[model samples]
Target: MAAYSVADGAEVARQVATLPDGGSSDSLCAGAWLSAAGERQAFNDDFTLLAGTVPGPGNKGKTATAFSVSGGSPVSTGPGATASDDRAPVFQSGTSTLWYVTGDRHLTSRDLKQPSAAPADHGTAPGQSFLLAGDRPWVRAPLEVTPDQAAVAPGGTVAVGSNLLWRRTDPAASFAEQNVEPAVLGPSLNGRAPVPGSEAMPACAARLWFDDLSLLCNARNTLLRVTFAPDHSRVDKVETLIPEEQGLIPGAVLSPDGRSLAFLREWAGTVDLYRLDLSAGAAPVRIASLAAGAPTGSGGVGRDVRVIAWQ
Candidate 1:
């Protein structure tokens, strides 16, 4: 096996705002940054969603956005201008669709038919947001929900912050949000709410990876494991990997078989990667380390672990 210098590994450990695929990537600084020209730019694999935040009147800082992309981008269909503030996008395999959560606390999805360059090539308008309740949909969604982060199980079930879990086996249903009783929720990341000095950590249900296990950022500042079974039983266990007094953020990836897990921890203003052997619940093994250099300031966000691969 090959190893890299700390400097080289740091250079390779680039912070990506978005990962469109294994080969290509995009950055919000370039695509989503607000310009003085009053136009917004959003980049996806095939289409770049752009909108002019219509100024004044009822529009103010929002407007009816339009979609555009390069010639080779994916073709969008299904919804109309119903989706706004698309972030943390993830694509389901073998489908002409893209799944993502909107800032409105609704898990809305878009359908793509082919790749394109200009936004007009995307045919569908957009879809309204869906309420995500626990395994059930209500005709009326939550009117007052604002989520900072979201994660999807491998099986496509969606989990939000520590307070709510939502799943829809069929698209015909509405997404619903089930408020988890906080009195009994903890011992794992999902069981606790964000404490002082750690508002950056994602909520328990929001930090999940794979189908059930998720990275749990606990009140003691430790990375742990949280699992939700089919019967809706919840289990919280210490990860025993990536130990930090300040805790691990919501940026962990499980190996394909769930035996090995990769996670990032920020300590003393530096960030590093650690691996754990889950076969016997071994402690985390440090693999690569990163520090924020003078030019590229570095820190972790809720969904910072965009991609991970092994030889």
Candidate 2:
């Protein structure tokens, strides 16, 4: 259910998403929404650029995967021989960008609009140029950050671990650490009271609609809604809209009209996609689901399928 993100350079932009590990999940695939169906047709196995075409018998229902690889693979020069991790891919300014860490431990981005053998940089570690600060203790996980375009603070900051930090790349300054203020936690996300010092945020997407600021986060298998001030410096309140008890809510997208949420959930080796009406408070309605005998560790595990973008 986790999603992808976009990495930004000085004047360039790229989007990224991670394919689940081949051993624990399926193969490592990544891309963005590039076709008419509103789904991204990612290259299979490796993180190669793919063309939009019909899938073969072995990949029916995998509408996102229209065809095979169309461009050559990127030059692996960052962390490992291949990519150490495929972080979240995101869309911005009419482009979809994906990120990959190389053997040398550097974050690189690929532009799908114009495939590139060379990717730009943010810095070392996950939060260098990426927006959403991912929370991965096991291995550094990727949280594709979404900036509130209408109201991005001086530096886009998010709750990272016990502290808050900005995910901005500064060629002139080193990364600084900041903390979420106590006053900011005065209100709870849901109706329940917020446990003092217990609200540690995972990777978060802070989006803006006109002057309204809202955020989307995934924690303990539940999706979080935390709206903030116009400048995005402090937390206003928090709400647990999609309760974790339903299932693991990994990938989610707010509808363009801002009326509902489209998400993917996993259980019993199956991943089902659903839509929740945020305004009506109605139960989620099923949209798409994996067929029987589909790949394991899909959906919630973020191995194969993901919600790249929502319209």
Candidate 3:
């Protein structure tokens, strides 16, 4: 794994740990959640999960069940048979919050610091607890909601995806929807090599980044920054930063500080990860490259190194 310092543009790469050689890289990319315990609840293996202090600088402590997706109902060790519909899990220790979008199209949360990094030897057998999601999903979707389409913002606001950008207060509040009328933002990436055999209209999906006063999303390949009205009434302004690409931009996630943006672009079978330092007026830096292809491991299906949570 490599850690890039945004401040100095210095890249430091180190070996995190040798992954189990048994699984394909695609399934190995299933999910990675950094627990408040300071250990990462990474996809331990193809089908099993293990929690231990990732032995390294700044990463220590343990791992545990962040919920399981295998079998029916998406059972969780989250207690009380609290099952969920998705795999993108975000753990924020500050609020002791665990958040994820439910299969029923709602953004749910619970107040539980991840369980202590338990012994992996107990076997990857999922506990009978069966609780996968938080008891109450704070945000509900008028339409189907997908994984990694929700983000928790400051000041008790939750932003979710549903074609239109929606926002609501924390603890199960009504959602206020905002529509964005896309306008041209000049041509696409200046030096970006276009995807081979481009499709006419890029498949549009929205990924959101929300702060107290602003929300940012990528729709129709355009990255738009929006400001909400006082008292969370409505969207007041929509400004385009990165315009729609000619080909496609599959995924994006905002940095923890919400200042930088990381996006993925796949060529043939390899996926490239890039980071845009929004705070710095610097060009987006090429960070890491990953292998993405047909899945064949324990979990035969998973995103192409799709980044679900960042913090």
TM-score of each: 0.48, 0.46, 0.47
Give the C-alpha lDDT of model 3. Answer: 0.38
Off by over 4 Å in 3: 1-136, 146-148, 165-206, 231-233, 279-282, 291-303, 308-311
Which 10 residues in a row give candidate 3 its minimum summed lDDT? 122-131
Q: How far is candidate 1 from the true structure (C-alpha RMSD, Å)?
A: 10.1
Model 1, position 20, has a per-residue lDDT of 25
**lDDT scores for all predictions?**
0.36, 0.38, 0.38
Q: Model 1, which residues run further than 4 Å from truth?
A: 1-113, 116-148, 152-160, 166-184, 187-205, 209-220, 228-230, 233-250, 292-311
* Model 3, position 103: C-alpha lDDT score: 36
lDDT of 2 by residue, 37-124 (tens): 1122123223244322222234332111111133222322222123133332222223344443333445545554444344666556
**How do the residues 120-184 of candidate 3 rate in per-residue lDDT, one tens digit apiece?**
11112121111111222332342443323333345544443423334443444233322222211
lDDT at 118, model 3: 23
